[model samples]
Target: MTLKMSGFNIHIVFDLLAASLSLVGTYLAYTWRLRAANAMALGKLSTGYGIALVTGAAVGGYGLGSANLILSEIPMVGRSIVGALAGATLAIEIYKRFRGIVGSTGVIFVIGFTTTVAVGRIGCLLSGLEDQTHGIPTGASWGWDFGDGILRHPVQLYESTAMAVFLVGAVIALAVRSPFFLKNGFYLMVGFYAAQRFIWEFLKPYTSIAGPLNLFHFVCLSLIAYAIYMILRSKDART
Candidate 1:
């Protein structure tokens, strides 16, 4: 048997290819409108893809850190939250000065965030078994087995399914002719995805603090809270 290793990851052989695909996949979704809103406007697709690229890297850095595979050549704080805010603010200022367009909120969060999660999770799968994960064992054929005869749940599949459903719903809202759907569509997407993730996290094994307060689940709770807030705010805005 041959051992493959690159700083703690097994699939380091094709790692770069996976990341390249993620970036390109996000880029294509972003730029699919095929036309700009106006002459001076930056294409919505470009702006959305740009945001997804930045955010994707930020999340990837987290995975790298978890893997303990830090590369010294790369800037330590690059793609971080503070860095993103600073970079985006500066970019927006320059765009404003030069009469270039900024992406809309709907584009940034819905398309960008969903694409980021979809692409970013691939890294998690590549990283494999390191990041938090858990699932039931099935005697049925077709499931991932890892770590010396340990049968594990395919948590990533659960998340990917959630993202796919949300993406389809988002496309429908954006493309179909329906005012009611368009008006609250974004908030609805957030709420549904957040709720699904929150519930699914329970299936994974996690430490409990005072009962059901693990790290992953805790983050899910935050998303749930934000989803609720987004729904309420959207309703108020509509009224």
Candidate 2:
């Protein structure tokens, strides 16, 4: 059902909250020695690597998101976190290859990225039908009515909860100094996010591109493959 909270838009509020929380989390992680100083150093925007990430994420987020909406015949702008991740991955890979950089430079962003998705999706849920991220109709007891009387799956919350669970696990892994997370946490997070997004796509009403799969299905699969390839090819894996 629609929330009757007057005045401010809940979606924008949550977006700000997500950003603030992500920044705080990143700062705490660095200050508390949860992430390596060197890795965090690489995240600096002054570096070319950071520029590539921002460029790729912006282009991909808008390009792919808008492409999906157009393909689905929806007359509105869109943005996809999945697209941003994929774009950033491609950009960073190219930069690393040219600069002879190796291993994952994305470990510093794993928690912050996860935190954004986990918290930002609540805004989507509250934005109601205008957000265009609602799930297909469902008969489940927990289904919500987003302005329209039809009970839908509330996939936004489902995704948010899933990422929140992952965030908890990631925090614990960091706290314990898990070697796997220290070396390959970025790949792990990408793979997990793609896997979950792939599943959630089935519950969405987006237009199908291949039989029953939508544009995001292919994107998710590509991300999963990318993550796997990177993890397998990592120097840590060889050692």
TM-score for every candidate vs. truth?
0.57, 0.93
The lowest-lDDT stretch of 10 consecutive residues in candidate 2 is 37-46
Backbone clash pairs for candidate 2 read: 1-145
- Residue lDDT tens for model 2, 62-129: 88998889888997778988999999889988888888776777777888999999999998888887
Writing each residue's lDDT as its tens digit, candidate 1 over 1-239 gives: 11122423533433455456546644554455312322133233355446654554456445433332223233333222212322343344344445543322333245555555555554444445543343556454545564435566566666766787787777665555345444444456555665676676566554444476444444445545655665576667757
User: With candidate 1 superimposed using the best TM-score fit, by how many Å does residue 138's alpha carbon deviate from the native?
Assistant: 5.4
lDDT of each: 0.48, 0.86
Candidate 2: what lDDT?
0.86
Q: What lDDT score goes with residue 201 in model 2?
A: 95
- For model 1, the superposed segments whose C-alpha errors exceed 4 Å read 1-104, 134-142, 177-186
Highest TM-score model number:
2
TM-score of 2: 0.93
Clashing pairs in 1: 30-45
